[model samples]
Target: MQRRARTYLTGVALAVMLSGGLTACTGSPEDEGGEDTKAGSSGAPDSSAPPGRYRTLPEPCGAVDLSTLKKLLPDAEGAPQGSSTPGKGTASGDEESPYEGQPIATYDTDRRAGCRWKSTNSLATRNLTVDFERVVSYDPAVSDDEQAQLLYDERAGQAEIPTESEPPADEEGGEGGDPADEGGKSGSGGSGEDGGSEAADSGTDGKGGGEGGGDPGGEGEKSDSGGGSDASEEPGGEPSPSSDADLSPRTLDDIGDNAYIDDQLDTGDSGVHRDITLVFRSANVIATVTYDQWLTDKRRTPDSAELQEKARSVAEELAADFDDN
Candidate 1:
């Protein structure tokens, strides 16, 4: 009887210990889950951070359109198999300002085009010398003015001034006839409407004119006059018959110093040998894209098939700035 009682007591002790352990585990489940949830939430990226889109250049770099480029500036006669012009190559490097406050256009020559494949050349011969500027090409079909505007817009931090502003006011008589008016003349004791009319007709009224002092129309006339003067002063006056400067073939010597490698390709017949180089100096940037092909010595039309194919590929790949491979 004594031995059996002792065994029962031991069983009771074991059962109680197991129950206590189970209670402890069950009670801590919510806390453990909450800790895990907190950790996951803390690890996520911050929602308020900026998207970081501004890290790239304001405008794309190393983009080109061969056909359009050809149309814009036809290579000069005997121009090496590329888009550069002969003497123009030195223009970019020359101290003379080719484009006011800007370096002349040139192709790019860099270390990238070593004899890994077929051909090699450098735009440094073109003489482009602007730092930090990048090359951006567009369809030659775009008007020169349009291209200029496009380039202007692509540059980061460049702002366009709103052309509209408050017109200058007349000081003296109402708007039109006041002689004492700061702008010109003012009207005596005329109605506001009459003063406005006079201002419109005479262009500028005398001083002393009420709030509607200076001739509103006068500003327009002055602007027109200024515009006319500018038009007359232009180098040949009356917009140049051709927006394109001489569109002729160019040689390698015509690029600028700031030139950098933009892109390159192997083109032309699989067997024949020919090399074509295209250089671009846009704004402060200079870049070059080269196309190499096997050209035959026979009397033949320029390698259109190879050039066209290569040009098309270049346009597709470099139409937008690409990452360096």
Candidate 2:
């Protein structure tokens, strides 16, 4: 009777285990459609996948303007730099090199490296980053007033003066004589003997020509005719006053490449190195160049204004082109 009870109990346990496996294989109707059930239960409508290119993003490319990005990020050290401004901005380290002039749009340094300035609204990922180096060079066209301003405000000081404000175009007058020359000749030839008498009478009549009052006619001839001749002798002067006072852009070659190299050189025993990285995401790829190496070089030795400008320009140019795709 005890053996029979044990057999019956064992059979019951096996039957119970089989039933559990069958239940596992056939879940509830809601479980058959997981996503649909989730949508219905949550009370949220199902959202289709985003479009191909911009579908993945909240907005299309170029949605964000350059100015907006600039506002979002503070101009602190380690912050991206550009070529547009004159002096350097306050980034990570000390503001040793301050920006001092009007922002430049475009410039070229060496044959291999030329900078182009542009702003974009397109973006693949929600985030974008750009880094550029400033190009530095001395400008021969900068006026003394500009130089003085540069001493105080480096960024404003480095601006490129426009063509209109610059010294007018050097002009050469034609060989043509002055119109007044005809009047003098008429006066001289019209009266010969009367000239001396007229001179004496004119001198007496005149209140003050000083010593020349003795010969009025002769004094008048000397004064008037001499003036004409002097005026004729003068050369054609500079062009009309320009509307633009900004200076022209200069390159490293223009300012002297040595100045650029010296600024990037290190005084300490540490070797020169560049810090750059390549970033990759699902939608885009980017090459990021940093100024950390530049700062390292500067720590060992100070760079010249020209060199600093070049470095700034390079950084800025890269920032401007940070996004190729």
Candidate 3:
């Protein structure tokens, strides 16, 4: 009986050891799963940051002041305000309405908006188009202002304007004659004077005086007249076209963060068309103003100074509106 009881006790101890080993093996997998879950949670990406600086855009048609619009499109002074609907016009056909402006086609109004005003009169035809773009930075590390500056630089590059406001060094050569040409003129003048004096000394004193005086006077007059005419006709004798200067984009100061003007003149069978584009960035918003004038007479072109003045005035008004908003 004692031997049987001892055997039963040994069997019970073996059962308890087996149960502990099974428990430890099963618990290891569960612990490992818990650790993996914690790691996954900690490795998740952060998505709580803000998305962009601007949440909304201003109304397209009402963005610019009415007075400014009238100044830009003089004929639109008495006309009604235009609709902001995309691809739809107040009139039945695509023809622009008398007083109402035209809405530019845009896929997204929240990100961009544009309006156009066109008027035809006996004196001239004028058209004004304005576009607004709201920039949003996706990079978490970049600020709105920095992103805006980058975008402005890109726009300026696209317009082919110099990054800075200064004119190029080559353009300065316009005012002064080339060094080589000046040197050649001086050499030729000296030779002519010397030849005239030599001829005078070889001839009779009285005849020499007359001949020398006549030769020098005639040569001096020809040279002076030729130089003056050439200088006036082609300053520096540079082949640079006047159109290049007119079309080249220029940077503007005292306007927004950065601003530039792009002027283009097109001559067509109908008449001369002048397009003046003024782009300025205020904070995160980019505003573009395009002023167009058409002259029926081919001989006459739109005044650039007047067009620029109108564009700048409109830009200032838009900037002020942005500030007010």
Q: State which candidate has the highest lDDT.
A: 3
List model 3 lDDT by residue over 184-219, tens digit each: 333322112122332232222211111101221121
Off by over 4 Å in 2: 1-266, 269-304
* Local distance difference test values of all predictions, in order: 0.28, 0.26, 0.56
TM-score for each candidate, following the candidate numbering:
0.25, 0.17, 0.54
lDDT of 2 at 179: 45
- Of 2 and 3, which scores higher on TM-score? 3
RMSD of each: 23.2, 32.0, 21.7
Each candidate's clash count: 64, 60, 1
Model 3 global lDDT (CA atoms, 0 to 1): 0.56
Q: Using TM-score as the measure, which candidate wins?
A: 3
Candidate 1, residue 17: how far the Cα is off, in Å: 3.2
What is the C-alpha lDDT profile of model 2 across 1-325, one tens digit per residue? Answer: 9999999999999999999978887776548689787777666333322221111221111222333333222132232234333223222453422121112222322101111122112110011222122211134344322332222122111122112222322221234366445433333222222224422322222212111112211211100000011111112111222323211222222221111111112223332222111111112111111121222222332112322232344434433433332
Clash pairs, candidate 3, are 79-99
